[model samples]
Target: MHYLFWCKDNNTSTPQDMCWVSLRMREQHFPGHVLCWVSMRMRDHLFPSPWQRHDALRAEVGAQAGAADTARETSTALYPLIVRQGMDKYKVLEEWRAGSFGATCIVKEAVGDGRRFAVKKVECIDEHEANLALKEAMVLLNLQHPNICAYKEFFITWDNTISSLFLSLVMDVSDQGDLGGIVRLKRQLVKKMDETVIQMLLGQAIDVLVYIHKQKVLHRNLKPSNILLKDEDSFLLSDFVVETLAADEMKLKIRMDDECKLWMAPEALQFSYSEKSDVWSLGCVLLDMMTCSITNDAEVAALLQEIRLDPVCLENVLKTLVGKVGYSADLCQVLLQMLQIHPVQRATAIELMDVPYVKECLILVGSPLSGVKKTLPPGVSDELYEGGIEKALEFMQIYTDFEDAQISALRHLSWYIADQDGWLCIEEIIRLVVQAMKLHSDSLDIQLEGIWILRDLVSQALAHGLNEECFISNELITTLVRGMRSFLPNTGLLSQICSLMMMLSANEVAAELLGKAGVLQDTLKIMESSLENRELCLSCCGLLWSMAMTESHTRREWLVYAVPVIFNLVLKHLHDGQLVESACCSLWILCLKGCVVEEQTESISWALLESLHAHPQRPVLVKNACLALASLLRTSELAAFRVLVPVSGKNGIALIKEIYHLHSDDPEIVENMCLLFSEMAHYGDTRPEMLSQNMGPFMREIKVKFASTEEIVTLAESTLSKLET
Candidate 1:
């Protein structure tokens, strides 16, 4: 029998690649025959056009026809089948799997729609096998459950050598592959599967079994290979084999292959089986999954042998194993009941569903909040972290009430989501936490947790350049600012609040909202009350720096109140690098807008220069210090002179030269130094000071060295021209 798979080449004008597989059975001298599968790849001539193509071929030809005639005749004969089965609407992408019995190929909608399906082909040697394959397809067609693999439709085709059954199974392409594959892969990662996941898998497996039993059907092949996982939390049962059950005879004899022996029940080996027989196989599957978690396969093999030797002692062994692996005791008991040696003693699927372990597992697996409890694998890559946060957020959206446990869970989950950088800036999560804070205003813990969550989210967002539309909402900003006011006296809470405010102010729209919502005043109050707390003061300084970067009106409002406070903080905390750095950053932004007067600029510049000299190695302080000086120098002539003059026997020119020499490698520092020299050259008095200090030679050298850099070259040229004039 020849099976062909065709895919349209959308990139070309014609279909260039058509794959064919010939499954020829070996000749036998006896009445009964054995099938030996051989797959050979063959490609045919390109079809004329996509519209006029054969979907599939099921011919009973005694002689080979010409390629042109075969194509013409097949297109005409298969056109009705293509339309009836909607085959033209889907094109074969590639073969997923192929074996003696059949093949599975991936097919996608030809209309460029995103829908995909796995199309399985079953080749039957005779009429009996065809009937059995059709019955299996019919059984799958009727079964629909969350844990059961979905079946779309089935069709029949025939050739002189064989009849084939084409079944479309609507299933997600499992990238992680089957349960057995996942177990083996996890073994390599050396990461143990968490018990919560095990319990959840067990519950889901039993749930599907229960459903199938209710419909009076048996999943004869119950093993890890047959169980497919859509994701970490979703497992589906697949590969159903249809068979009859005798009313009086509880057992039906069947061939037991080596693969089947691994999961087949003992009673089934003795040719006596029932629904409880499936329960025994499920026990074996559970054991397989549990043992797979062991990093050493040898240990798993030995453990399995021990359980097989003393079936009744399986409970004790499982208990020890699960306990060592952190599985719950309830699950141990459920496994014990399911693995009972006698068929009558084995727990039925319905009874298994009622088990406490199963119930708890169902709740945890089904609950959206359960994702928060999962222990992510080690080295949790950025992709895994983001996926976890997305899953948690999806789960949180389903529940509204702010119960104590739920609130606490959300608080910790927020920490986890915020623990990593590059969060996708989920606005809904931010709004939900903000609403939680508003609703539970009385709970200080909830408020603090919510505030920290917002702080981390905003920090990551700003760091990763996430959009600011959702964060700048009136309700969120207003709620946060109000929380800041209410939590004023608490130093830790106030620090986080200030930090969050700083990040929010990074966005112009958010800054406008914060300024309008009285965040400026509330922050001032926090600074006033926490004057002695350097952390709080540092955080407030950072917040003010962000606020000063907003529109001119907002910058002016902040400068009016921030200038004096910042100057005092700088003078008071000259020895503290962090406080000095933050204060300098704030002053830089304030002065950039010409918001500082001559006296304030002079005092702030002198203090900053002292801090810069004290902490020459601090890159952040140096960068901010240079920026502040440049801004002050560019403000006005008087402001420039006030800041340029010597203080405490040290000249401002000398200090600027020292900073320039010390951190020449920093681009921002270099750019700002050039700008300061340019600003100084624009003034007549400082122009002589520049010449006296030999600034002309330095400016010429800078101009040549940074010729490729526009900002530096432009500023250097302006300084040299002014100096020469």
Candidate 2:
């Protein structure tokens, strides 16, 4: 049935403009032009050609659209031979599943029933090639079991070359949709399923596995999607394309699909498989069912270890076999034994069936006996076996995917909004993360995540927002300080913690709390470290700044003990521009209280002033140095003006003159400088002898810049006038 197509125009606004296709069918030689308009919204506003519009279905389905219905209508071309052999008599319905293997439906009369039955066909090949439906029909006919799907028939009779098949359909017994959907629904309806119901459903699955294995068959791909429950109790297994013959059976020449081989047993994955191999696959399926969602391999391994060690908490069992279907710890033990990597030691299906609890399940969860046909509900498709993790990850990795471990860790600590129950969840999550870390402490992912979680814990406690009581006062400080040293090279984590401390330690009460908590010394060591993370170092400086400037005199004394380290850092980095800026800010924070005469202020100023003259390129260093000296001179009440000359080394007055000149517009800097001058004026007034030596050059520079500087600058200039007035 060949057809020729021509062009048409489009009206809708989309990337592919509307393309009208003219068609001529070979059967009747009927000629007609169908308007198969592509979207008017091209890449931005241009239209794609007719062929491109037809090929974009896969991309368009997942994308957001406004004119999808119209686009679907415009793209349906008869020239593509819409009606093939077995499907010619049927009227095409809308698409059923737009999954990796596309499946569409049509209404066709049943051969035996002579009534209309919905026919679904999956196609991944050209119209001339055989479709997945044909292969599926051939594969399903060979299976024979009570819990397994029964093949009704196959259809592909056509005089012409077009060939398609139809077969019996299985009901979509997905709990909600997929496993994620089931988990979400369970969260909403957790109280609905009694312990008995859970046991029944799980037991039914076990029975289905047993029945499947007894037929000398290995359902290599056993998963949640393969196990469907009708009315939440009757479980049936379906969809077997990669089934393998038992190991002891005579070899059969069967074609295998390498792509679907991942779900096979580890031994089978490397070699041939036996019916016991199916048991290992069943273990993975059970893990998915219990977790209610798929997990990464690492998490799966972790959960398996926990279950092996303490199966009672992680794996529950049924005490009584009420119906015939039931659970017991012995059943789990048997299943675990079958999943052993050494196939020789693994329990055979016959051996597993003889277990007492297995016998109980067979009688309790009796298999369904009816062969009635049931129409599957909408929204479910047979594409459930997309791929095992390796394939999924391989597919996703061809592009790029991203996640942040830190954010994941912090969010793990989030609390519930109303009852503050989220704190308990956070507590459990932290313990899990910490345990995982203890097992793999060298793991960068775990360390990064742990640091962020600790930071959030501290922040949340200070905010008094989340009701989670995961952290005691001392525990919070201990966790944070330990994270700082352990998570090396992650300056972002360090800075984040430092910023959190700056906010939490701002109040005197919090600082006192932190000091007794033993974080104060660790924080001082971090501040004095020779590391080069300026932002993180500055954050440490900010915390100390908060502490020293805090109102508590006792806290101020603790800060004073660390002053020598601070003073040394200022001298060492006085020449390096970036470090100088940090050192200056630290010095400003430290000098909140005026230096006392008996304090080390005199020696500190001498050292800082010498560095300022030597590192002239560091303007910020000189600026802060002048400010610190001004603060100290003011502390002396102008009595220490005599030290200015020796400390400046002839350039000190010039630096001070420049500091006053450039920052004169800033009130704070100008006011501090004026205080220095006013104090010096008092010294000159008390003993006019000191003024004669150094006042000439300093007085001239002050006089020249007085009017241009500030009124306070002039007042300080006139205060020098008071000394000689």
State which candidate has the highest TM-score: 1
Please list the C-alpha lDDT of all candidates, in the order they appear: 0.62, 0.46
- What candidate 1 gets wrong by more than 4 Å, as runs, is 1-403, 415-425, 459-466, 470-472, 552-555, 642-644
For model 2, what is the error of residue 631's alpha carbon versus the real structure, in angstroms, after optimal superposition?
3.3
C-alpha RMSD for every candidate: 26.5, 28.6
Best candidate (score: lDDT): 1
Q: After superposition, how far is residue 712 of candidate 1 from its true place, in Å?
A: 2.1
> Candidate 1's residue-wise lDDT over 541-639, tens digit each?
888776655432142455667778887887778888878888888877666555677667667677777877777777787776766676666656765
Put down candidate 2 lDDT per residue, 1-725, tens digits, no spaces.
Answer: 32333232323323244333334434223122111111112131132321122123212322312233333454422213222244444444446643212233435443555334334333222222232334333434434333554444344222223332122232222232333235345534532224344445445656566555544445655655455544445555654433222221222113233323434566665557677777766655554344422344445445544443353534342222122223345655655665566678667655766666555555566432111212333432222235332232232233111123222322333322122433334454445444333323334565566555545555555566653334434234434544555664667776776776666565434564455444445556776774455676667766665555432212334555566766676666555566655556556445434322345766666655666555655556555555555555545633354345555456444555555556655554554455545555555433354354455455555556555645445546655675666
Number of colliding residue pairs in model 2: 24
* lDDT for predicted candidate 2 compared with the true structure: 0.46
